[model samples]
Target: MLQLQVPCSWYFWALAFGFNLAMHNLKNILISVVIVSNLGKIIRTCTCLYKQDSTEHHDHIE
Candidate 1:
């Protein structure tokens, strides 16, 4: 009985550890994705603004 109980307890602990690790990794991945998406949007916005500004500046040159 003791040996069987020990293996059961170990299995339960192993499951719990794996679950915790997976949750942590998932959270990190989500956070990184959000940050990357926001950065891309910001870069795109900046480039658009720069192009508009340059075009308007050229129109005024003549």
Candidate 2:
């Protein structure tokens, strides 16, 4: 009985450990994706603003 129980407990612990590791990795991936998408949005917004400013400036000069 002792021998059978030890192996079963070990298997359970291993499964738990793997699950925790996977969740941690998934969280990191989600965070990175959000950060990257936000950065892209910010870059696009800046580019649009810059283009608008340049066009307005040229109009004033003309």
State the lDDT of candidate 1 residue by residue for 1-62, as single tens digits: 99999999999999999999879799888999999999999999999999999999999996
Error of 2 at 34 (Å): 0.5
Q: Which residue pairs collide in model 1, if any?
A: none
Runs in model 1 with CA error above 4 Å? Answer: 1-20
Lowest summed lDDT over 10 consecutive residues: which window, candidate 2? 20-29
Query: Candidate 2 lDDT, tens digit per residue, 20-47?
Result: 8879799888999999999999999999
- Poorest stretch of ten by lDDT in candidate 1: 20-29
- Clashes by residue pair, model 2: none
Cα displacement (angstroms), candidate 1, residue 13, comes to 15
Candidate 2 stretches with Cα past 4 Å from truth are 1-22
Error of 1 at 20 (Å): 5.7
lDDT of 2 at 12: 96
